[model samples]
Target chain A: MMKPGTRLKSAVCDAEIMIIKIAESADLSCGGQLMAEAPERTEGDGDRMHGCLIGKRYVNAEETIEVLCVKSGDGSLYYEGQELMTKDTKKLPSSD
Target chain B: MNIALLLQMAAEACPDRCALTHEGRHYTFSELFAAAQRAAHHFLAAEVKFVALMDVSSPAVPIALMGAAMSGVPYAPINYRLSEAQLTPLLDRISPAYLITGSEIVAEDRSGWVVRSSEEFMSVVSEGEISDLAWHDDPSAVAVQLFTSGTTGEPKAALLRHEHLVSYILGSVEFMGADEAEAALVSVPPYHIAGISAVMSNIYACRHIVQLPNFDPQVWLTLCAEQSVTSAFVVPTMLSRIIETLQQGAMATEALSSIKSIAYGGGKMPVPVIEHALALLPQVNFTNAYGLTETSSTITLLDPDDHRAALEQSDGPIRARLGSVGRPLPAVEIEIRDEHGAVLPPLEAGEIYVRGPQVSGEYEGRSVLDEAGWFPTRDAGYVDDEGYLFLSGRADDVIVRGGENISPGEIEDLLHQHSAISDVAAVGVPSEEWGETIALAVVTAAGQSITEDGLREHIRNHLRSSRVPELIQFVNELPYNETGKLLRREVRAWFAAEAA
Candidate 1:
């Protein structure tokens, strides 16, 4: 089972994420393609859309699946072509 | 999932920005990354299983911390204050380690360790040819090991995995959120969990770091001005001393003009001390963080807005939050449960149970997490109707007298309100009449005195008769550890000698 801290790479574009969480048999995709655990195929230069940020977290609408983008990509992250929204951070004081 | 990714990301994002400042030197993010890379080579060359740091705040802290992560070894910071008899065995446990300390001491008991002074280690790592070795990416691997200061037993080795710390950083801190002019001053000692989290969070925020080697209230105020520090973390004891120094009005406001925010934790902050601080430094923002080493630093915080709101209202629910530690972080969930494992409602104090991705309540030999992934923190605290938390002393410190439970925090808070008392600690002592009787070690205010009967009369007026202490001693000061934790175990011993 895919768990938190598991890394996944996009087969279509230069998108990489670490799994914050995943649902049972949830469809995890990036750039409209299913991401893979191994780098079986190198990323290609695709047109950039809905730019994914390197340090941003993405979650589905129901918010069951979550991922943290480790590398900025040319294509946006999605769940079977449905775009996941960026999670807003609740800012707290910088306590050491 | 190595913590090295944090530094690498910062270096790549802003290579030329200032990352650290010590005695008189400033290192850019790129320079710090290079030093870490060099240090990784040292750990690899020596083939050490762990990188142990036994020193105070210095450049070597980051070097060893990041370097150890890059080399796939746990970064264990040992408490150097431990005596030779108590320290030798701990060093042996982390044998084949690269020990970095303030001064090189002869390890008359160990041979596998490579001991080097922090200065020498820094110089050596700077001179070495850079090794481009990649960091180990195992998320479950241990990132840090801290030894808890147990009064009666051996110190427990608490372990934090890479995932635990990364989750905390991701949940609470924003990446590159700090502005170019923003700098954070860190004064906690190396062995403290806050010390490690300070370095981690600052690197991710891309803020400049200024280190205070030794804690002197005057020196801290002077350095804040010289370095243009915007934020800082201080223990309760340190904050009280700084407040005392500021009361003298020895220097102009310009000496502390750069300070913007101050965060305090590591002990129960006396209400009077915090109230005085807020009144004096009206321009400064204050935050109270509460957590344990196993939780990878703070799990809950009282933000500045909450602090202001609490101060604005004197007697309402809003003002009550001043004593509260606020709520849990977004990623964490907290529940107060009784001894029978039944969930308690709001305003009921019980054992604090927490469950989250960042809670790694694992020791060297045993894991404290229950089957449901919940870790029971031995601390005693309760939540308000709105989810704000108020911490009492440790659950173990609760005193039972005549089959009634009494919290020392309630007694200490009332004592703090007394005009003649400056600091106080209420502890349980062995008693024949009752199971345990309350004892007070009170520190009188400057140029003030109060008789034991007068103090008891004051307590009896506000609280119940059971809350009044049977034994009271007007001492000059109470016992606190280096990190500002009140030594209750030692406080309990104070009355023991007199009774004997």
Candidate 2:
């Protein structure tokens, strides 16, 4: 199970994701494959199936889990068998 | 998590983007990250307990900061201006440290300490191959140790844990939010909290940074125009100098047009100076960020929109807002409290207290947090009906005369409005009859002269008679710390010596 602040990567694609939140019993997948620690690698043509854009955040339908795409790839992010959609970035007041 | 995660994430998102520029040299995000990784390995091999940088602004500042994070050590940037005697105790406090120094500010070498010049340190760190160094993810690790500029008392090391700094960045800044071409100019010294926070926030926002080791008005304006700098953070003194430079017509008309935003803090901003700046740079967004070393930089920001409204709109409510520090950041909670610790109502001046994840009241081994986790800022201020915070000044600077507590800030603020008064400071001296009496030190404007009674009459017209200074002394200029905080204690001492 992935948790907030966890750095993960799709075992099937080059997509990188940082988990923002997750559920008690939820499987986070990308390109129809389970997630793995960033250091681990397993190859598949997951990029050809779905695309992940750079600097975009993807959230599940229930909003229970969210991940930011640190690097763009041809893989889509999913959680609990549901594909996540891009979330609109919120403008924050500048502090510096 | 280690604070280095912010840099790592930025490098991953945009490896080719320029992360920093120093003395005409540029380092990409990926290159800086790699250097930090290798430096961490070197730090571990040397077995230093802390990573201390005792140099002016340079590429080594960012590298040392990130390397310290990767090594699970606190990054302490010592003030190079301090004398050997003054630097001894501070260096002793952080023993067994890997010190990186520039040309002539090297401290005495000791056992368990490794010292390297900036050039040597950079060359060594840059020559090695990237190591598979494991960065510690302990949230409780001390990430930064910044010594407070003790204009009033001895300097104390304010501790910021990994969680405190990281939470501050995550809550306040949007990740990868800045446009690719955006760059920020950082002129504050690395030892100040604003300088450290500016670097982290700019990197997290995916923006480039240009560091000015020493502040010069002409150089700053030239850098902004040349580098296409969109944002910058400066102290009130720096802003005042820049404004004065612009008023003298020394800067090109189009020189500062490239700057989109400018944030000023570290001291009280005179109303006149800000008004002048607003009129000069109409297109630039002016922000007043108010924070302390313990609060991870900014707790409240007078935003650019508020600046514009206060300047353009004539309504009393909107215009009065110019003197405020705006509202608290979304992640911060603020409360004004009386001496009894009871919360004060709106418009009632009291001590300003703040609570938040970013608020680290840790000093050395002591934690000053109250039972409810609130940190008393020791600042006197009142929150307006609209929640805007107006700081009166440091709580210790309050003057008690004839049983009435008067904030020097209010008196000084009013004194600044006088056309003949260029700068002013109000203090309380020992009065035989009353507990204390108000004293004013005035700096007249260029070629302008005013008598003691003339200054008193000017103040008497605006404020209550009791609030007027019983004794006024004209001076050339008031003393200020490097970051622009007024040395009120010194002023009080001067008054005492004169009375004797």
Candidate 2 local lDDT, B381-462, one digit each (tens):
9998989999999998899998999999888988788888899999999999879999998899998888988777877898
Docking class for model 1 is medium
Per-candidate interface DockQ score = 0.57, 0.42
In angstroms, the error of model 2 at B380 is 1.6
**Model 2, position B253: C-alpha lDDT score:** 47
Displacement of the residue B216 alpha carbon in candidate 2, Å? 0.9
**TM-scores of the candidates in the order shown:** 0.94, 0.93
Candidate 1 lDDT, A6-68, residue by residue in tens: 778887767788787754554677666677776566454353256677778898888878888
Report the lDDT tens digits of candidate 1 across residue range B111-228: 6678889988999877767856856888899999988867536788999999999989998999888988999999998889999999999999999999997999999989999999
Expressed as tens digits, the lDDT of each residue in A35-88 for candidate 2 is 767535555544435788765678877777767676676667777777889876
